[model samples]
Target: MELRDYLRILHRNWILILALTVLGGAGAYGYSLLQTPTYEASTQLYVSVRSESSGVSELAQGTNFARQAVVSFVDVVDSALVLDRVIDDLNLNESAQQLAKTIDASSPTNSVIISIKASNPNAEMAASIANSVGTNFANVVVNQLEKPDGNAASLVKVETIEPALVPTSPAAPHTAVNIVLGIILGLGLGLGFAVLRSILDTRIHSLHDIEAATDSPVLGGIALDPDAKKRPLIVHADPRNPRAESFRSLRTNLQFIDVDGASRSFVVSSAGPGEGKSTTTANLAIALAETGARVALVDGDLRLPRVADYMGIEGGVGLTDVLIGRAELVDVLQPWGTGRLFVLPSGRTPPNPSELLGSQAMQRTLEALAEAFDYVLVDAPPLLLVTDAAVVSRFTSGVLMVAASGTTKKPQLTAAVEKLNAIGSRLFGVIVTMLPAKGPDSYGYGAYSYSVQEESVSPSGRGERRARRSKTEET
Candidate 1:
């Protein structure tokens, strides 16, 4: 994917990512609160060797010996030999092995100093344990290990250099660091999930998906309306609505389809049911009629018809009657609204819809209507469900496919297109409906309003000025 694709995914799922990050941080903080606070204290011991010679070389030798011996003494500080004495001195309740687990010993490289650190729940107890371990280790080495003969002075001496102090804060629960790490981990997981979901989802949610699926140019996109079912005739009922404006845009785009002045008849169909193909056909016809063009909207779907109901016209006799020679085209065609639009509703449900639509009579009816009207829009059944749409498409200029955003799948659309190709039918273009108004993949058109001032000559030969309100688009 490109950088823009990743950015769009992030924009679409930002709330999920943010929610997971906050939950991770809160969980880390809660874990920290449940842990026992631990305090650490450290003490340093200095080791030195005595020599009888007063020469500089002899003193250097003694220093080297003490440095080597201090390395070994570091391990002895955490041993049972010292920890057992510490337990006895402090009267602790734990065993020597358990107590040794709380102590740590280390020495700097080539140094005669050994550092002993101890940890406990109590700060004072931590300090006392570190100091006791240091004092006991010194006594064991001087009075027993290094003592030469009875009553003789010891050759090695271990002195307390830096005593351990009680730490003010605990080291185990690094609350701030843990919270930051948790947030980073959560963010990684959330981004991974978002990308995976985008890849796995097959539904078309944006114009980009439609473009990637087919080579057909997108005429226009209609924003989803909550009241679409109640007011399907948006171009007639509410002409200023944004959804209505989108139909006008579709109509404008449709004009360029037949630039050479060929037949302007088009079959409006979808891959599946409920994709807004019927409503789109009715609205586009109304939009074209508003521009003073003669448009005939036909209900070609013999199985089910909706153009008559949406157009608020009589549906007792229409396309089926005309095709069967029961009624003439002029008698069944009903004019709608104040425009030059006409509606030819499906007369009755036929037992053989595919056969009737593909018959020669159907082609003659479309040819007659195409010659009479500037534009003829035939609302057909879903192409994937039956052969009616593909059959009728042969009689018109081409098929106009309607895809619903986030509802139509890529495989379904591809199959629909393949069905048309199998029958040698032309697909004019694609119309995307039910698009979101806001988001990374929303419709890009913005609503705009402007004022136009006009000057007219009055009867007395005086100029009169008037201001008119007009909107280019509405949402």
Candidate 2:
């Protein structure tokens, strides 16, 4: 989409580019080794016209005739007239027609000099062929085209000027040059393939893609953790890990979404399932609770409840029972850990989940919960699957769509945002989750100020550091 995006694609596929370049060079080297080495030898001959007249005009005419005759001699060298005698003198293995392929003849521009070049597998054989072809061409020019000295005035005379030299090395199989060309071709193909993949892939992998499609600001980014399935609540499982630090970063960014406090009561939903929506929601509540704020994480997904399991809390009864008047709101609100965070599981699956989520009772319960706690984070169902989240958003502040990096498609995420907008519900912002653990998308920035004191350094060089939570944006 931009120069930085293309640069990132190249950075990600650098290995592929390097491997293809090496393979191309190797292929070129192997092809060179298999080719037959060829040796070339060249010779030069001078053509002249003799005149008996002592006048300057006659001398000029003779030189002009010789220059015109040189062109005809060049073409005649490849003909059978000269080639037959060359083959007879040198005893070549090829026929006259076949020998033409190995021979090259040409004359310099506005000059009476003809050059003969021959190529062969043997250096000595190539030199002999060039000399033989030149000598035969001279004989053809003197006898067939010009009169003898006794018969009439001799018009043309041809003589060998530079003899052919034995070649010391092969002219073909330029290994280094071939290898360079191969490298160029390989890099071209690699770049083309990288660009093609980036264009064809519709999946979202960065905060830029989300921001380009929606009006919402990018609130935070979560690094991809392959082992997240084993332990969904990473903030509670490993408090000092980098993945947990990402959640805290998200918690900090959430406060700055809107100065009017609309983000405190928003549903976390994705374009589809398996995008770490529940895990992000659970971790955000934990991070918020760490700030001394009372947070209630509700499993609003009647079909697939995960907040209770992720938090390791009771899931037998939750928001559903309270909405149906079967259980009291105070009785079902369960406190977690040593902080003020609470978990409200999605009691049981209901056949009509949409109708119940949009009921008047659901609105009253959400409002009551909102007033009771500082933040009410509802882990609603995916927006694409059902209208429950869209319906529930009317009761809460808005929706915070979490798009999974490298998995959620851009069009799918766009449709989800449009669904909320079509219903006149506000989308708080977007959270890009499960991005690569490194690069620009990672959640380690200068804004997160943390360090260790030099005096606290341990003997093994490991020290206990402290991080001061950011209360507001830097000026």
lDDT of 2 by residue, 224-322 (tens): 888999988888898766778778888988877663543368889999998989999999999999999999889999998988888887899888898
lDDT tens readout by residue for model 1, 1-475:
8898999899988988898888888888888889898899999999999998989999999999998898788878878887889999999999989999899989999999889999999999999999999999999889877789978898899999999998989877888998998888888888988899899988988877987888989999999998999999988898767788788888888888853355589999999999999999999998999999998899999988998888887888888888888989889888888759889999888788898899999999999999998889999999989889999998888899999998999989989998999888889889999998888778765454445576778899998777665554232
Q: Choose the strongest candidate by TM-score.
A: 2
Residue 271: error of model 1 in Å?
1.8
lDDT for model 1, on a 0 to 1 scale? Answer: 0.88
Cα displacement (angstroms), candidate 1, residue 321, comes to 3.3
Clashing pairs in 1: none
Off by over 4 Å in 2: 146-150, 259-263, 440-443, 446-475
For each candidate in the order shown, give its overall lDDT on alpha carbons. 0.88, 0.86
Best candidate (score: lDDT)? 1
Model 1, runs deviating above 4 Å: 141-154, 259-261, 448-475
